[model samples]
Target: MKAKMEHKEKKIKKVWRNMNIGFKSDLHEI
Candidate 1:
């Protein structure tokens, strides 16, 4: 159970990282 939760957290972190990167790039475009 703990391992599954950790895995989920890692996936969430990756998604957030990608979103942040995209947002930064969008701002640069503007």
Candidate 2:
């Protein structure tokens, strides 16, 4: 259970990181 939770947290972190980069790029473009 702990391992599963950790995996999910990592996934969420990665998604958020990608989103952050995308937003930054969009802002820069604008």
Evaluated against the true structure, the overall lDDT of model 1 is 1.00
Candidate 2 has an lDDT of 1.00
Model 1 CA deviation exceeding 4 Å by range: none
For model 2, what is the alpha-carbon lDDT of residue 25?
Answer: 100
Mark the 10 consecutive residues where model 2 has the least summed lDDT.
Answer: 21-30
Model 2 C-alpha lDDT per residue in residues 1-30, reported as the tens digit of each score: 999999999999999999999999999999
lDDT of 1 by residue, 1-30 (tens): 999999999999999999999999999999
> Each candidate's lDDT (Cα)?
1.00, 1.00
Q: Which ten residues in a row have the lowest lDDT in candidate 1?
A: 1-10
**Total backbone collisions, model 2:** 0
TM-score of each candidate structure, all chains considered together: 0.97, 0.97
